[model samples]
Target: MTTKLDGNCLALDTVSLSRRNKLILDRISCQLYPGEVLGILGANGAGKSTLLNVLSGELPADAGRVLLDGVVIHDMSVGELARRRTVLPQQAGLAFNLAVREVVAMGAYPFPELSARDVASAIKAALQCAEVAHLAERRYPELSGGEQQRVQFARVLVQALIARNPGEARYLLLDEPTASLDPRHQHGLLGAAAMLAKQEQLGVAVVLHDVNLAATYCNRIVLLAAGQLVAQGIPAEVLQSGYLRQTYQLDSQVIAHPQHPERPLVLFA
Candidate 1:
């Protein structure tokens, strides 16, 4: 990744983290640019989520810095950060049985300036983007796991859209968002993420366990192993057989997707 300073990029500058005497992340450095999807790929316990939490300012980097648009993220106020970025965790808990629209409406809390009509419009647009418009009135708790995940996607989309600042780009951080979805919905969710990066000029960083999904949707890929950055580059540069074997400890074949030659397809043994 390029280290050139840009006011439009979210970056990690040799960031490291530790917990209970264990190093969870070790000097990971990368940049997420506006209008691009950067994918984080790793096996279990590779510290993908820890890296994301640090980027989102949910957890501080013990050694280095996490920057948003040339400003240190930790120095920014919570409201300021919330207005510019939204995170969707691996699992989100809702204590009450809120309707889908109500859950999405919670994203508007950061912007008290929005009128009721404006919030409603934002929610509707988010629902349509997430393909959950028909579920707007449905009870969130009663929906299937996949449906609930899509609803959460809508909520974050609303958060990203309504709080956007002019002359600045927003960001979306998603952790394992496709873990609960079927094959089709997995593509839908990631497709929407890619669309957001391209059409809305939002910087997106997503943690994905599935390498193929990352390759299909991401503009760049970061491979992590044992809390360190194994490789960071375009998918074709990083998803080779050697890197896959080192990261996953498996033999695999990497090939170009016939339909989309720029995208690599992995066949694991």
Candidate 2:
């Protein structure tokens, strides 16, 4: 009964959500398309994560709807949804001792019939993409926070790649993907995501607190304030100083990136 849709677009139509008589999202709407990275930006408690949850179909909207390639998201089965998208949460916890390779291989669970060689190949490719190939044999719990985050990213990458349908678009939903990473890894991860969007045509939506990173990597930015979408457009248009000041309530300077003049750089005043 499920039909695959043409083109690649994840759209939210006037979506709204409330919890405990409190509005968590107010008639929010947006679209994420293939071949582009969309950055979701907001201050603390600005509903960035909540919006991600809604888009990923983990949380239902009280009004409006979410569509993945024109099909209602809730209409798809969990297995079908997993095959179309992968989510990397802010925190990845592991209570048991597991090897990094083992963690990465977990991403291939959806492809049960894949040959061992295929699974190994996918795991290796994902680890290399995430820059964690050197830690393959190490215990995951023994790695540093940044290392673990990279491993988790690799896992999701493998999941996305393997779950992808031929000629169909896939999505990656990441929540604060760079929170524990060092400056180098932060850019590296986002760079990888950008490459995936451009090269593989994956639709990537990431929640980021760093303004400069979003401006540099994402083709479009969505700024939220108090659970409502305040701005959504290219970084130059949405990352204006006035809009940022009003939303974040912080005095800041918005300048053009010296190297990429078209992109804006945000600096605290």
Candidate 3:
């Protein structure tokens, strides 16, 4: 059976990471609350993925802390962490061919004792949510890149849903989820994530390269430059041309979206 997760918060306090005395993240602090999608935006080498890793607890912060519902994440056991959050990297590879359904079912591995019926139900819900139900029986390797991405997303969703404690918020860290997807699938994937944040109250943080996509889908954005947070706020506040130019070093024009005036549309110069 699917567990109902309660809305909660994940917070980072002055998180920093370094390698060989070189800073990769510079005391960045942020919070992701339930019922919201937080986008991480930065140019290449700006530490977007590093921040995601820290938030996910895959990489330890050198000089700060990450808290889930006020509990320090670094102190949590592997199983405890798995029950609360899942990370979907840019690429998930499989050397051996597996059916889509089989691959998605892997997400439930954390619950090895679950009944077959329960596992099947969780996988089904995930596939439908990720818009990959039609490909469930297909071979994962045979599917197109976009199809594979959807399948992997379904896996991550299933993992989060099955492992979460009832009434406790879960988290998802997606690193460049739309990188390999076409325009339509890109929107579709992010749309599903947004729905989950609003409906299921999952705390979602996605690393994105597309400014327009982030503006349209994110509740708030954190802009990073050279490992430091430059600006963070609602899309309208942070998508200003000045910030974009400073971080991305690209001249761009920002205009109000004709349809959604509250959101900005970025046009490259």
lDDT per residue as tens, model 3, 1-269: 32222225788888989988889999998888878999999999999999999999989999988888888888899987887888999888777789999999989987888999999999999999999999999999998888888999999999878745557788888999998899999999999999988887788999999999999999999999999999988999999889998889999999999999989999978
Q: What is the lDDT ranking, best to worst?
A: 1, 2, 3
> Pick by TM-score: which candidate is best?
1
Query: In model 2, what are the clashing residue pairs, if there are any?
Result: none
lDDT, residue 78, model 2: 86
Q: Any idea what lDDT model 2 has?
A: 0.91
Number of backbone collisions per candidate, in order? 0, 0, 2
Better of 2 and 3 by lDDT: 2
TM per prediction: 0.97, 0.96, 0.94
- Tens-digit lDDT track of model 2 for 202-258: 999999999999999999999999889889999999998888987799988888889
Candidate 3 residue 82 Cα shift, in angstroms, is: 0.7
The lDDT for every candidate, in the order shown, is 0.91, 0.91, 0.90
Off by over 4 Å in 1: none
